[model samples]
Target chain A: MREINVAAITSCVRQMCMDANYHLSPDMQARLFEAAETEQSPLGRQILEKLKENLEIAAADQIPICQDTGMAVVFVEVGQEVHLTGGDVSSAIQEGVRRGYQDGYLRKSIVRDPLTRVNTGDNTPAVIHYTIVPGEQVRITVAPKGFGSENKSRLFMLVPADGVDGVKKAVLQTVREAGPNACPPMAVGVGIGGNFEKCACLAKQALLIPTDQQSEDPQIRKLEQELLAEINKTGIGPAGLGGTVTALALHVKTYPTHIAGLPVAVNICCHVNRHETMVL
Target chain B: MDCRISTPFTKEKAAELHIGDMVYLTGTIYTARDAAHKRMMEAIRQGRPLPFDLHNSIIYYMGPTPARDGRPIGSAGPTTAGRMDAYAPTLLDLGETGMIGKGRRNEAVRQAVIRNGAVYFAAIGGAGALLSKAITSAEVVAYEDLGTEAVRKLTVQEFPVIVVMDSKGNDLYEIAASKYCTE
Candidate 1:
């Protein structure tokens, strides 16, 4: 068995949080550039150009791309043969978020309680998802999710009769409602199948897929491409002021489910979809 | 329409703006978001003085990151204004003439804007780092404990924003969307 200290995870999480906030992923940036070049609306093109400029400023100055530096959402994949030591993995990851937000000057956006609504002061208690996999290594991904888009995410539990068209209708409806609110052009993360909570997680995890890359599954790839085209036809455009590119890409993940139910979850992300991954 | 304007906007000054006008604002403004707005309203209920002037003043719905060394502010972008919808109409009634934010406002906010002849500007959302470049200086004026959500007095120069909803009730969102929506 490979022994790993939780401290290493902490350090990795810390850097990932800061790095993700400061830099837009290259593939996503390329999408924005492509959108700028192809967008027909004058204002939409202008907005896309400004977004690119915003990314450059964030990277060069090492500041967050957006003030809503977002709540840190982490995904951990641990090899089944690995033994964790030195500290608890959960606490270690939380500590990383706290230190990263504090040291990096990223905004501390978490609240102590949903009811009382007091700031936690340090961004902490990262929403963590874990999986046990094959190798002896631990992989951690940090995606700072901004609430503007997060607030617009939706989950629909459809009866089996709803089928694929139902899923499409649900997604399109969610995106249409999100409109200017989700900060279009958006990257839609869709999860189909699985149980309720699992489907929600899948939607979020789908967002981690490289936007430029397409699903290898031919059917899924076709659906993704079709969705992207239909969404852009929305004319919600760059900042939702109207254009041909409402969304940059759609990341869809599907799994097996119960015979009676069809569950679909859409986790919407704004143009500033910030995420970073590290392995140790 | 590319327009240049300064703050401390009166009803008449604000009325000059129309939906679709791309404006660059230079002058003083205040910042407040969810927590600070609640506190301000609570203070008003308690018959206490507000932290800053409200007359003809513009409030930016934002919560910014901490500034790094030698900088006056950090990445400062508009937050979703809809979150502040509950407080916006009341603030507009109190003579606050302008609000800078992103996203559509509630019907009440739109009504308030027209009733008071106030203007609502849309700052490019997700462009915080670029937006910060326009803010020359920032100082927390109230609710210090609110951290990023504190009310800040800011001096901005050539701050770019678009007139999303104007005093006359023209909404750029509807106007612009109709121009391009294929679906």
Candidate 2:
């Protein structure tokens, strides 16, 4: 069994949080450049150019790209043969978040209680999802999810009879409502065929897929292309100021659901979707 | 063409702005978001003096990240204005003339703008780092305990924003979307 120190995980998580906030992933940056080329509205095109420059400044200056900085959402894939040592996994992750936000000067947005609503001071208790896999290497992904677009996410439960068309309608409706509110030229993450919670999780996980990457499944790839084309055609454009390119990409992840139900979840990520991953 | 405007905007100056006009705001503006708004409203209910005077002032709905070493402020950008819609008309009634934020405001906010001769501006939402370049200085004027949500008095120079809603209730969101959105 390969033994790994929890300190290593903490250090990895800490750096990932800071890095994810400071830099826009290369794939996302390239896709935004591509969107700029096709955007019809002069204003929208200008906004895209400004976004790219802002990202560049953030990276060069070693500062956050956006003020929201977002809540840390970490995904951990642990190998079945590996064993955790040194400290408890959950606390270590939280420690990493605390140091990262505090040291890196990222915003601390978490509230201790939903009702009373007091800032936790340090962005902590990261939303963590874990899975066990076949090999010995552990993969950790840190995606700082800002609530602006997250607030616009939606989940729909449809009867089995409402198939692909239903999913399309639901996604389009959500995007329509989002308009400029969710920050256009957005990335759409669609999760299909799972139950309520599973579908929601799948939708978020789907966002981790690089904007330039396509699904391996031929059918899924076709659906992603169709959705991307249709969404861009909406002309919500960049910053929702009206343009030819509203969405840079669409990612779809599917899982089997019960015979009676079809669940679809759409997670909207703004142009500043920030995520970074490390394998240890 | 871009217009240069300063704070404590007069009714005439407010009326001069129209939907789609670009602006470079230079002067003093206050910052407040959800928490600070609630506190300000509560203070009003308690018959206490507000931390800052409301007359003819413009408020930017934002909660910026903490400043780094030597910088006066950090990445500061507008937050979703819809969340502040509930508290906006009250401030407008108090003679607050302008608001800076992103996203569409509700019917009430639109009507308040027209009725009170106020205007709303849209700062590019995700362009916080770029926007911060225009903010020359920042100081927490009230509710410092609110951390990033504190009410800050920011001195900005050539701060870029677009007129999203004018005093006459011409809304750029509605007009622009209708004009440009395709099937």
Model 1: per-residue lDDT, tens digit, A86-122? Answer: 9889999999999899989999999989999889999
Residue-level error in angstroms, candidate 1, position A56: 0.8
lDDT of 2 at A212: 78
**What's the TM-score of every candidate structure?**
0.99, 0.99
Which regions of candidate 1 fall more than 4 Å away from where they truly are? Answer: none
lDDT of 2: 0.90
lDDT of each: 0.92, 0.90
The residue-by-residue lDDT of candidate 2 on B127-169, one tens digit each, is 8888888999999989999999999999999899989899999
* CA displacement after TM-score superposition, residue B14 of candidate 1 (Å): 0.7
TM-score of chain A of each: 0.99, 0.98
Give me the TM-scores of chain B across the candidates: 0.98, 0.97
Each prediction's fraction of true contacts recovered: 0.82, 0.65
Q: What is candidate 2's lDDT per residue for A213-243, written digit by digit as tens? A: 8899999899899888888777777777778
